[model samples]
Target: MDVLIVGAGPTGLTLGIDLARRGVDALVVERAEALFPGSRGKGIQPRTQEVFEDLGVLDAIRAAGGPYPVRAIWKDGERIGEQPMFEPVEADESAPYTEPLMVPQWRTQEVLYARLVELGGRVAFGHELTGLEQDAEGVSARFADGSAVRARYAVAADGGRSAVRRALGVAMTGETVDPSPFLVADLRMTGLDREYWHTFPRPDGTGLALCPLAGTDDFQLAGKFPEGTEFDLSLDGVRRLVAAYTHLDAEDVTELRWASDFRPRAALADRFRVGRVFLAGDAAHVHSPAGGQGLNTSVQDAYNLGWKLGAVLKDGAPEPLLDTYEEERRPNAAAMLGLSTGVHRGEVQRGKATVQLGLGYPESALSEDRRAAPAGVRAGDRAPDGRVDGVRLFDAFRGPHWTLLGAPAAAAGVHALPAAPKSYGPGVFLVRPDGYVGWAGDSAEGLGAYLARAGVR
Candidate 1:
């Protein structure tokens, strides 16, 4: 196999789809016997929506989810007022997706997994990784059932308690974002309207909220508790907690589907790559889940690494091209960790920062700007969506190949757009497979060298 992915969550499944579409042989393994049965990580930010579009799962995702509802604050069983869940941002031509969508994490995984299988990819359920070893050439992984698989590279997407990360002896440097424990669950309930998120805040600085999960008949119940409290995960415990906090009785909670308790925290892996092993998703970084950055950041990590791996393993790119994964993603992960912590502590609002449309890698070794006067969309920036010369920019960049705009001549494998979008200013742009401009110039003067280095010619 070209790659062994350790986990079948959104991160690993997404990587599997990217690699499979690129014709790279990759396998995803999950310890769980089935997909996770919960509504955790329920927010899908705008940037991730673009990724899903490129992976060809956006329509299914949109069909399976809905937009976030207004928060309805309640005091003493009476509705005080309504507030927006996030700062509203208008959608424009350059940036089409503006707001976050509410899709249960399990549903999101289902969409990604289906797309992976459509691309002829496979995931091995019940394959629990026990040991991992790496050499100069490849990585060897051993499962609990005495089975072994070797691949040219391995990715640790097994989540925050990653067994693969532990095997590689990579440390995570982080701290607790909140000392207080919290409970989150998906359950059917009554006495709450489906149009609004019901929130009940107490005077003691602790409260609970019940939000109707979009595209489902369940409500996601989240409650904050005092430190040192041992909350129960049972249905009865959830009923009692809800009855105590809300106006409804315990019986209002009709059925419990899934429940889990956790303390919000933020942590990042000390390193993303260890020889032939790389860390992606929750295995590499743990977030507080406040600004909905954890799963999105994890998915983007897979996106940033997928093409580079494809370039090296298939296109004969130099090995050093792999090093940019850490140099580009680690710092971005660190910034997201801080943003997540800030949102959890009410230090930052979930507006533009959480949208993540502005993220890019301007300082990476692969990014080249030959233009003397760079403006608007420059190298290392995300290529915006627009229509140029009667061709949609996103449509031109939808495949597992590079895109060159404002270039008349065509390279062998690169997609060339004769005209640049008005929003892109006057310059030639080479958009990477991951949709970031890798090189920019006044003309196509230095485009050949950049494409050669990226192994795109």
Candidate 2:
């Protein structure tokens, strides 16, 4: 296989879809017997929506989710004032998606997995990695079931407690964002309307909130506990906690679908790549759920790495092209970790930064801007949505191919959008397969060299 993905969550499944679409042989393995069965990581930010669109799962994702609702503060068994959960952002031509969508993490994974299978990809459930060894050429992974598989490269998407990362001896440095224990669960209940997210704050620092999960008859219940408290995850314990905190009776929680508890924390892997092994998703970084950055950052990690791997494995790009993965993503992950921690501590609001539409790699080795008077979009920026000669920029960039805008001459192996978008000003821009501008110039002066280095014939 070209790649061995050691998880089947959103990260690994997304990488599987990208690689499969590029005709790269990749396999996703998950220790769990099935997809994740909870509503964890339920917020899909706008940037991730663009990724899903490119992967051809946006329609299904939209059908399975809805916009976040306003927060309804409550006290003394009565509804209080309503407040917007996120700062408002208007959709424009440059950014069509402005808000996060609420899709249960499990449902998101389902959509990604289905797309992967549609692209002729496969996931091996029950295959737990017990050992991983990498040499100069490839990586070999041994499973708990005594089976093994070898591939040119391996990605650790197995999550925060990733066995693959542990086997690779990668250290994670982090700090506790919140010392207090927290609990979250998906359940069916009564007494609360499904329109607003009901939050009940108490005199003490402890509180509980029930937010109706979109596209399902379930509400996600989250509660905070005092430090050193041993919170219970059982259904009865959840009922008692809810009854004590709010006006509803314990029986109001009719069905408990899933439950889990943890203390919010932020951590980043010391390194993203170890020879032939690369870490992606929660395996690389763990974040506090605030600002909803964890899963989105993880998915983007797979997106940034997917095309580079495809270039190397399928298009004969140089091996050094893969090194940019760490150089570009590790810093981005660290920034997001800080943002997540900030949101958790109420230091930052969930607005433009949280949407993540402005993320790009302006300082990477691949980004080359030869234009003397660069303006509008530059090298390493995301190619925005616009129209050039009646062709939608996003439509031109949809497939597993590089897009060249304002090309003065024919490039051998790139989709050419001859006319430049009016919003982009005037320049020749070479957009990478991952949708970031790799090179920009006035008249294709340095374009050939950039393309040659990126393995674009």
Q: Report the error of model 2 at residue 315, Å.
A: 0.2
Which portions of model 2 miss their true places by more than 4 Å?
408-410
Put down candidate 1 lDDT per residue, 1-457, tens digits, no spaces.
Answer: 9999999999999999999998999999999999999999999999999998999999999999999999999998899999998998889988889999999999999999999999999999999999999888899999989999999999999999999999989999999988889999999998889999999988876889999999999999988887788887898999999988989999999999999999998999999999999999999999998899999999999999999999998898888899999999999999999999999889999989899999999999988999889988988899999998777788889989888888864577688888788899889998999999999999899788887888775
lDDT of 2 by residue, 83-123 (tens): 99999999988788889999999999999999999999999
Clashes of 1: 0
User: Which regions in candidate 1 have their CA more than 4 angstroms from the true location?
Assistant: none
Residue pairs that clash (backbone atoms under 3 angstroms), model 2: none
Output the worst ten-in-a-row residue range by lDDT, candidate 1.
Answer: 407-416
Q: After superposition, how far is residue 86 of candidate 1 from its true place, in Å?
A: 1.1
